[model samples]
Target: ATNPFTITKLDVNEKPRYSKEAFKTSTLQRDAYNYLGYSSTRTMMLAQYLYEGIDIKGETTGIITYMRTDVTRLSNEFVDAAMMHIQKNYGAQYLGKYQTTKDQNAQDAHEGIRPTNVLHTPEYVKANVDVSSIKDEKLFEDAMKLYARIYGRTLASLMAPAILEHTKVTFTSNHHDFNMKGVRLLFDGFLKVYEESKNKDVLLPKFHQGDTITMDAIVSIEKQTQPKPRYNEASMIKKLDELGIGRPSTYASIIKTLIERGYVTKEKNLQPTDQGILTSDELDKFFKDIINIDYTAEMESNLDKVSEGNYDKLSILKTFYEMFIPMIENAKVNMKKIQPVMLDETCPRCGSQLVIRKSKYGEFIACSGFPKCRYIKKEEAPTDS
Candidate 1:
């Protein structure tokens, strides 16, 4: 096996590809979680400030379009201004065609989340946001950071496609074909403004059709199969988006409700509480069909149809009631009662086990031996430091 590697073929791609469109609520949340480690709820809150009009240069005006939208469309005015801005700053060759891709589920009620004015650079917007008016330095910083992302993405969307030289090389030895691919950046088009969080260019060494490669050690590596990862706020929202389960405006509230109901907790990632798992298991045993993810998605789709006047509201309601009323009746009689989720803490007053409970206000910690031991834990509110 002298010179055990031989190059058999080389193929390269000549086409250029553009970067993704501007931020919608789902994409924005995913990027925020990945880059800033901000939760979905927090990201929405920060985005809302930009949309609701910020105090800029002593004047109150909105700096970005509506935040709670799934649409990626840009207005004709915005597209023209952005193209002109690109032509002036980056040159005529860098200008891109104005087009947007949307899924069928998109409402298309508002344009993508973008800076209301292309000239309103993130730095300019931040400088003018009066600290005296906002009164919080951290809030100002977070809002500006998110605003920068939206601005950059919007600009990048209208920039020329990045030209890349993708080379695929095949090596042959002992009747075995091995493949390797490399890419070189021919032109950094949209990349000038917005850099994607994942993926980078890999430049490969020059290879001809007939070239010999020196042999390296061949190894069969053993790898352990990884388990499916649990979903965080961003990933959970992504899943929901794919399933068309909830609207953009409701995503933050939905996640917030999960936390408030004590079903989910925020740690390194969004983790479901043990109580949450128990409740899910109990519900699945009794109402698996009603609470299924697919069923939820179907219900959402039906609601959309009703809103669009394509489906009859009464007919849908009738079908739902026919399927649901019997389940409710059966659950009332046959569903087993679940035990309280006890905490590791013991009540100071009666030395009884403390447990999590839900009330009008929200979840709270109370004694498991409730009627006998009337103990409730009061949490101190966090103050701005």
Candidate 2:
């Protein structure tokens, strides 16, 4: 249904939009690894240190709530405290409504990540944690930054909706229709505390419905369709959450395992290594059932059921063993020994020829001279013409 129409009206609207649910959802979606392209496991470890009593000054006390959770449910006591803090600091108008809905798969035992005491702001923690002769100053700073993010998110979740004004202008040229949108923040509200939540505003000139304007220039740029992009650490973790492949508690570990096992390499995004591709092909040829995505997701579901006491854990293990043991035995005999691809270059450290070797870590260019020379370099991806 492609039809051209004249501009009927230039519309403008203003409304208040709540950010609590959005912040809660996005907090889970934003993985720590992807934020700085570092190890997610390290982020979790630091969060754990904050959660489990860190020595602040002389007394040891937890700085934040539990970090190993997918749930975004906040306890009433914490919510009330956060609301009161927001009202006291910002004003009465900034206090938001409390949220109650929880995800179906989310465990009810743990609360969403938040500061242990709203009164102890990130600034106070940073000042207290700072030591004169601190050996790991960077770690302490990073922990403080994370603490601030958690504090801001928690407080923002209990603040009022951000008010915005939106305007749309429609135009028609040669039976073709086009439109432009403009948005401006009318009130900061929760965004006053969570500065990261603000979107870039597009200011537009005032216009009437029937007003005509002359065009300065017209251009058409040539472009081609692009293939789907590869997944990054954050996107991959989000996908895992959607597919029920693993719990939030295990996401960091899963990523670490993939990197350690040489199954995936992180550059700007996660890319399968040469060894990884070969291993996958071999597994697909011999054990498609075991390596299947659906099967793995189903097993995760079964494990969850077992945890909930709906399924027998031993029975599930027995079923998996029955199917897997035979495959393992068969693969041991049939699987071919994969040889490394020898490269044209020589090792810089040693005079030996460089060979692309596959290890438990990943594929790398290593010196052929075994025990004597152990120099290695990361493999580079091929370039297009």
Candidate 3:
């Protein structure tokens, strides 16, 4: 069910748009969040260290601009500096017109993520920064890698758009339609630096719109439809951002809490444990309003309003507590403890029944005789269908 499946029919648009702005925006956000698999909080923490003064070559200097920003707007001074750096480094052809589009919900308090000095290339930083003096070579290395990503992305954002030629070929045979697509890069433009945006080129034979093509071979393959994928760290953060459940500053802490508690495990993907499921079920049954997605999103919006001075903080708190306090008391009195589920298998190390136990790392099988026989094993994750 997790494997890829074959497609039978494909229809191509007459005039396909080659612009990648819409796709780039979402991709960049994910890339930034997932930088080095660091949680949003970790990324910001490391970024802050870079932004704050670091002892480098007997001088204290910031390596990057402010990192806690939801807006992508750059100041005129920085924009001009980036343009000059781009022109000097990559020639005038790579330069692009600077334009700022404001997002209504964006908190434009600081400039978007960018290098403090555009000319301070990642290679130069890696070569010059005295790792021995810093006492942390790995930290300095990671900082350089992250700086490169931000530098490339910020510079690419201001560079010329990549030009691509998309060609789609569709064929009709026996009342069935088969299609193939081809994409050729006409110009690299910004893709020269940000190679992650480049898509694999699919070349197809030349054919006119009305032309019919013969098939070389035909085969039927069996495949199953896969269920929706579980959220990883990057996707989870992206989802929270899209749902307006948390602000940029809180994303990392929120995920960290889930992991620190026994709610979710980040083994390969974020998967809820038996304890998490039970807790969610209880909350859904007793305190649906407070634990609901919509309610939480609305609360976030209200908090934003308070920050903007549009809503009173005390009034909002009072209104929330009026209903929340009763629910908390009711849950405290009525909530039941979830019983451990015993497995058919016995502990490998001890001759005792194995039972499912929940921990910070999720569900695992442990010997029933805990203190006497401290043997435990990780439970296998379920396959998606």
Best candidate (score: lDDT): 1
TM-score of each: 0.79, 0.77, 0.74
Model 3 segments beyond 4 Å from truth? 1-29, 32-36, 39-42, 169-179, 197-224, 308-310, 340-385
TM-score for candidate 3 = 0.74
Please list the Cα RMSD from the true structure of every candidate, rounded to 1 decimal place.
5.2, 7.0, 8.7
Candidate 2 matches the true fold with a TM-score of: 0.77
Please write out the lDDT profile of model 1 over residues 127-243, one tens digit for every residue.
Answer: 677667887778878988888889889999999999888899988988888888888787889888887775666777667888989866666678999998888888889998998
Q: Is candidate 1 or candidate 3 better by lDDT?
A: 1
Global lDDT of each model? 0.85, 0.74, 0.71
Q: Which structure among the candidates has the greatest TM-score? A: 1
Q: On TM-score, who's better, 2 or 3?
A: 2
Instruction: List the candidates ranked by TM-score, beginning with the highest.
Output: 1, 2, 3
- What tens-digit string does per-residue lDDT give for candidate 2 at 1-385? 1333455458889988676542232254363444433456767777876787656686777988878776777788878888888888899988888775676656556787888888889877767763753457787777766676777777877888898788887777676767779876778888887655334568666667877656555455689999988987777877777776777678878887888888888888889987678888999988999787798888877887888899999999899999999999999999865677888998898788888876675457788887799897765799998
lDDT of 2 at 165: 80
Residue pairs with backbone overlap in model 2:
none
lDDT of 3 by residue, 175-265 (tens): 5655668865666788878756334678554345555455667666789999989998778877876776766677777888887887887
